[model samples]
Target: MILLGYGFIQKIGSRDFFFKVIIYFALFSAVNHVYLVVNWAIDNPININRLRLYAGKGDVIELFGFIFIFCRKKLQINFRRKSYVKIAFVLLTISFLLYFSRTQAVAAIVIISSIYGYTKLNKKAIIVISSFVVLAGGFFWYLNKMEIPRSAEGLEGFLYKIKNAPKEMFSTDINVNNRAELWDKWRSYEAKLAIEQVLNDRSSTLVFGKGIGALVDLKDDFMLNGKLERKIPTIHNGYAFVFFKSGILGLSLYFFVVIILYLKAYSLKSANAISIATNNLLSGFGLYLMFTTLVVAGLYNTNSTVPLILGFILGVEHLNNLSVNEDSDNRN
Candidate 1:
C-alpha cells in the first residue's frame, strides 16, 4: 500500500493537486466523524467502545488532516475558503478528542511542538507548551477528585484511561491471578513474555527472529471464549512484535527506515509553503512513529496510515527534485 501510494503520487505530478485532494478527503472524513459522534451521543452515550467501533481507523487519517492544516505556512487563501478550512480543522480536532486515544493525542502534541520549534515559532511553541501543561494539570485534578474507575463509561472512562496510561505502560505490579490485572497491563505483559521467549531460544533466532506467525506464550489462556489458547500471535508493542517475529535484524531494519525518512525530511530546504508543510509533516511523522511503536504497534499495524503518509511525502520530494532538474536544464 505504501509503495502503491508513492507511485500514485508520482504519477499525479502535482503536489498542489494532491494536497487539495487530501484536504477535501480530510474535511469529508471530519464531517462523517462528527456525525457519528453526535449520533452515538444521542443513542449510546454510556458506551464509549461503541463510538470507537463506529469510527475505527478514521482517527489516523483525521490526524493527518489536522497536522497538514496546523503546520501550513502562508498560502494565499480568500477569506471564505480560509473560514471553511478553519471549520474543518476544528471538526477534526473535536472528533480526535472524542476518540480518547492517548497515543494519538500525545503524538499530535509532539508533532505540533516539533513543527513549531523547527519553524522557529518560539512564541507559538511556548504558548502551546504552556497550554498543554495547564490542560494536563486540570485533567489530573479531575481524575483525583472524581476517582474514576477502569470500567467507567463515556467521558469519565476516557479520563480514567488517561489517568492509568502511565501505569499501563510501565507498572510491574500486575497480579497474575487477576485476569483484569493482566488485561490492564496487557501490552507490557506480552512484551515481557516475548523477551523471555527470545532469550530462552539458544539458536540463531536471536539475530533472525522466530519468523512470521510466531506466538508468544502468556503462561495461561486469557481468551474471552475460555478456550485453552495460551499464546497470542500479536503484541501491542510494535518493537516487541517485530523482534518476536523477525528478530533483531527486522527491528533494526524498521528503525533504519524511520531514521532515513527523518534525515531526508530534515535535509529538505523549504522554499515555499508546500515545501515547508511537507517537510514538517514528514519529520513530525517520523518522530511520531518512533513514539507510537512502544504503545500501539506503530508501522506494523495494518490499520495505520503512517506508511502511506511516509510514502506520499517521499513521492512529493521526488517530484520536487524532478521539477528542479527540468528548470535547471531549461536555464542551461
Candidate 2:
C-alpha cells in the first residue's frame, strides 16, 4: 500500500488522476482494514451483514470527500484553520443527510449545498454543480426502478440449487434472493471458482463461449420420483455470464469497454477539482457497485450505467473547456 501511495504521489506534479484514485482507494482501504480487525475482534467472527453494509458506507465516505472538494472550490469553505468555517458545518449537516442512504435524498441536499456554495461563485459554476446533482439523481433513480431481468432471475434460481445440492447441481439464473437472502455466505466463493474454471478452460470452449442459448439448455427439471429434478450451466457471476454466452472473447470485449470508460474518467484530472471529483466518484461508485452487485446480482443488471454515460459527458466537457482555454490563451 505504501509503495502504491508513493507511485500515486509521483503523479502529483502532472495529470495523474488515476494515481490519485489509487491513493483514495488505498487510504479508505487502510481505514477499512483497521475497522475490519476491530469488528472481528469485538464479535469473534466478522458479521456478513456488516460486510454488506460496508459497501454503502464506503460510498458515503467517498461522497463526503467529494463534498469537501466542492466546498474548497466553489464555496471557499476551509475547515482546517483556527476559527471554524461556518459553511463547513452547514455542508457537513447536509452531507450527513444526503449520505444516510444510497438514494435520491442526495440530489435535493446536493442541490441545496451547491446553491449555498454558488452564492458567491459564478453562474457557470453554479449551473455545472446543479447539473451534476440532477444527472446523478436521475441515473440512480433509473437503476432503482429497473426490474431484475429474467436472465438474472434465472441465475438466482440456479444459485439456489448449488447451495442445496450434494455434489451434483443443475440450474439456470437462480441465485438472486429477495435482497441478501439464501446461501450468499458461500455463493461468492462458488462464483469465484466458476470464473476461474471459465478462465482456465477457455481454449476448449471454441474461444467463442457456450453460445447464446447455452443457459437455456440447462434449465430443465430432471425429476426422478414424480416430485422434482434439476438444471445445468447455472453460473451466477457476470464475467462468467459473458464467458458462458460469448466465451473469453466476449468477456474480453466487455472488460475492455469498462476499463476504457474508467480511463476516460481518469483523463479529466488535469482540468479542475470538479473534474477530478466527478471522475473519482464515478470510478469509486463503479468499483463499489462492481464488487457488491457482481457477487450478489448478475453483471448484466449493471447496478448503474451512469458512470459510463457520465464519462462520455466529461469527454465532451473536456473538449469544450480545452477549446475555450485555447482561445483565451490566444487572446492573451
Candidate 3:
C-alpha cells in the first residue's frame, strides 16, 4: 500500500504533490493530537488512555517536523518570515505537549535546530545556540509544571520515570517501577534480548538470518510469559525485525540506502531560496526518519510510512535536479 501510494503520488507529477500530502498529514495529525490533549486536559468522556488515534506516533511526529520545514521553506500565504517561523514553532511545541512522544520530539528538535544552526553558522552560531537553549528551558519547564487532570494521572505519575529513563535503560526489571523504560520495554530492551536469543545458538543466522518467519518463531521464546499462548506477529523495533528476518546483510543494505539518500539530499547545492529550503527540509526529514525507524517497526511492517516519505524526497530531488540543470543550460 505504501509503495502503491508512493507510485500514485509520483505519477501525479505535480510539483506541489509532496507539499500537499505533507501539509494534509500535518494538519490531520495536529488535530488528532489536539483532540487527545483536550481530552487529557478536561478529563472527558474520551480519556487519553483509551484514545488511540489512527495515525502512527512516528508518522505524526515526522509529519510535524516536515510541516515545520514546509512552514519555514514553502509557505507564502502572505505571512512575514517571522510569522512563518513562529507558526511552525508553535505547532511543533503543541504536538510535543499533546502527543507525549519523546523519540519523535527529540528527532524533530535536533533536526530543526541543526538546520537553523547550519543556516546561521556563517553569520553567528550564538543565536542558534541561544535559541535552542531557550526552547529547551521552556519545554522542560512546561513538562514539569503542566497540571495533570485526575483522570489522566498517569501523565504526572511518569515524570520521575521519564527523568530516570537513561539510568533505568540497562535494568532487567520490566515491572511497574521500571515504567521509565525507553521504547516501552518491548521495542528497546526486549528487542535487544530477542537479538541475543536468536544469535546465542545460531551465530550463522547473523549472516543469512533464520529465514523470513524466524522472528515470529522466536517471539514466544523471548516474549512469552507462560501465561499467554500467543506470539507477537511483529517485532517492535524496525532494525531488529530486519536483522531477525534477513540478518546483518539485510540490515547493512538498509542503512546503506539511508546513508546514500542523506548524502544526496544534503549534497544538493542551490542559490535559489526555495531550492535551498526544500533541500534542508528534505535532509531534516531524512534525519527524523532515521531515529523513528528504531522504534517504529517500519522495515517490514505493511503500514510503514517511510516509503511514502522516501518517495516525496526522491520526487523533490528529481525536480530540484531538473531546475538546476535548466539554470545551467540557460547560463550557457
Q: Which candidate should be chosen as best, given lDDT against the real structure?
A: 1
lDDT of 2 at 140: 51
- Top TM-score model: 1
Question: Which lDDT tens digits does candidate 1 get at residues 1-332?
Answer: 67977898989886765556666677788788778778877876566756787765346777766766765552222234677777777887787777767887788877776655542335775777688789988977777787777788888777777777766777767788987777778778888889779978977998988989888888986674366778878788889889999889999999997776555445656454455555565667677888888888888877677777767767886776777667768989
Each prediction's TM-score versus the true structure: 0.83, 0.37, 0.70
Relative to the true structure, candidate 3 reaches a TM of 0.70
In candidate 3, the residue pairs with backbone N, CA or C atoms under 3 Å apart (3 or more residues apart, or in different chains) clash, namely none
Cα-lDDT of candidate 2 = 0.43
**How many backbone overlaps does candidate 1 show?**
1
lDDT tens per residue, model 2, 1-332: 32343343343422234323422443354355445545654765433334334423324334433444444434233335533334434444443332233222333243334323331235865787678779867865655465543233233433333333322222233443432332333344345445554555557674787666654222234332364534334544566567666877887887775555444444553555545444444443344334433433323534433333333334434444555588769989
Candidate 2 deviant stretches above 4 angstroms: 1-182, 189-206, 216-236, 264-269, 289-293, 296-299, 302-332
Model 2: residue 172 alpha-carbon error in angstroms: 18
- The lDDT values for all models are 0.73, 0.43, 0.57
Off by over 4 Å in 3: 1-6, 36-62, 74-96, 114-155, 167-184, 216-230, 269-271, 298-302
How well does candidate 2 match the true structure, expressed as C-alpha RMSD?
Answer: 17.9
Weakest lDDT window of 10 consecutive positions for candidate 1: 71-80
